[model samples]
Target: DSIRVGDSLTSADRPVSEPISTPPLAPPTLSCLFGANNGPLVGQEGSIVTSSKIRARLISETDNNVTLTVESCIEDAEKTLVFGRGELQLGILIEQMRREGYEIIISPPAVVTNICPDTGKKTEPYEEVVVDVDAEYSGSVIDSLTGARKGVLVEMMDDASDGKTRLLFEIPSRGLLGFHSDIATVTRGTAVVHHCYLDDREYAGALGSKLERGKLVSCELGKATLFALASIAERGTLFVEPGDMVYPGMIIGEYNKVTGGDLEVNPVRAKATTNIRTVLKEEKAYLPPPKRLTVEELIGYMNDDEIIEVTPKSVRLRKVELDSGARERAARVKKKRLQAQMQKKK
Candidate 1:
């Protein structure tokens, strides 16, 4: 008689499937390197801290997810690097770690490109996208994908019976970054999109940024006040609720579509209520629900000079330089560097 031992059965010996084979590791299609979170809230909520702990967690990730690879930076041993198939795949790991009480800071996802030694041509990853949506929304979807993302529709099939359309496009891997949420919104949460690697293509011209609006930065450090949020809500969407902790350089919201500059608001300012006027006389504070950015959304929303601070309890965005004067000075230096590079190219 066969007896159960742990998850398997064995008396003398029971027949079982042969040992599973481990495939050779393949180079990642895309990769993004991330470091430990060193923000103002570091170690406040997360149990896991220190470089050794972060490295151990990342090593476990690569061991389980074969497609992922982890390496240490040659220059900085404290910094850990992760390579993966795509932004979503890597972002999933970060989200999981955060949920498990690990705090880490992530850099913006960068496409892994190659350059030909002889031809001097740059190459980047591409993906074959298959999308299905209602016929009525097809036009808008097509326009959006093709116009801004530089996607080429290879084939379109219309099913009159169901009034649905199927679209196939060969798009750059970079183009698909953060495009998922937009597709859902455009299709009213009904679009079904799938993508797979479609070989690398020659470098294309620079595509525009996904985020067109500027972020709302905090100018003070304290718990957010309802009165302050009410005034800030008119400027753009809020990311924090009343009594939420905020700090200088922390991003509180997005700017209005028409407004171009980054707005610095004091979210902790309190209202001066006169003794004579009752609380009922004050205008009702009705602030819209803050837009809680998901991992993918946060990756798409980040700028070159910004960092995403992740904790066990929350995910927040802030500038690299917290002081306003320092931030502006850094911007000037960046601009100068850009101008110098442009001149060198010329």
Candidate 2:
């Protein structure tokens, strides 16, 4: 009274919800667009546990999340750009993913611009930026936004008597890459910035004005000495103090002066002394405590020629052209190109 046909049973078939004896087959393909796992606190607390566990979760995610489409990219086999919201949203997702166990390397957020084949004009995506901050901080925000080529101010309204103000501007995506930290600092952590993409338009002139200030770089590699830091403290704010390990070209602090210049101050030098037997205890080193930069601050402070090297444990700023000789050559080439452009304009 029963017919056997391959794996299918014929009692004329069973209900859809009823159990079948055969095991399910695996899907043909699965992949993921991984993001960065930066900051010192990542792996210390979370489920999923190891990096491999994170990878497994991502692959499994593809099975359940219907919206994501994964594919291989030639730029780096280990990296994939999950094309979705801007870096901020993607960053939040990456943070959450890392909390769940995946260790991924994320590049700086860049706009994927399009070229008009007909007119050969370069285009970039724009954004609508909304800012809620104290009234006093409005000027700096306006100046910084304008400098970045953010479009006209659409509105400025006062928020309820907490002495807060709300400002809105249509900004280009390129202009907003590192703007969040600057807004926060300027408002003393009281400002909130919300932005979403607008439209793709002509490229903005440049977006580095907000990060134009120069940085204090370490001229040598060693543990920072208190004596040297005390002497160098007058030139600028200190980023590292005594006993902190520093590497050459490492950005230690920001200079106070507006005009850009690199100061060669070695923080690891030891004091020389003669063996005169004086019974006084060693003088307490009076060094100013250094400022520790957060991840947002570090990103906000880097220039176009530099990059923020992030790891699970640390964030380091380095020249995009890492080697000294290569950096110098690149600088020269850039300078020459600028000079030629200026000459052409004249």
TM-score for each predicted model, relative to the true structure = 0.87, 0.68
Query: Per-residue CA lDDT of candidate 1, range 1-346, in tens?
Result: 2221123443456566753345544356666556777777678889886778888889877655767888887777787877787767877888888988888877776778888787889988888899999999898788878876878999999999999999999888888777888888888988998888888778776886454788899999889999999999998988999989999999999898643868899999999866585556656888888899987788866777787878778889888778999988887998899999999999
Return the lDDT, model 1, position 40: 74
Question: What ranges in model 1 sit over 4 Å off?
Answer: 1-27, 209-211, 257-259, 273-280, 341-346
> How well does candidate 2 match the true structure in TM-score terms?
0.68
Candidate 1's displacement at residue 210, Å, is: 6.1
| lDDT by residue for model 2 (1-346), tens | 2332225543646445553575532121112244343323344434333434445555555564433334445675554545444544444445556454444544444556778787789877777889888888988888878775566688999867788888989877667666776677777888788876667678776655443556777767778887888778888898877877666666677777776755556788888878787888978667667787654455435565655544444455654443456767887999999999999999
Kindly give the stretch of ten consecutive residues in candidate 1 with the minimal lDDT sum.
1-10
- RMSD values, in order shown: 5.0, 9.3
Error of 1 at 45 (Å): 1.3
Q: Which parts of model 2 have CA positions greater than 4 angstroms off?
A: 1-109, 116-120, 159-163, 207-211, 279-283, 321-323, 344-346
Clashing residue pairs in candidate 2, if any? none
RMSD of 2: 9.3
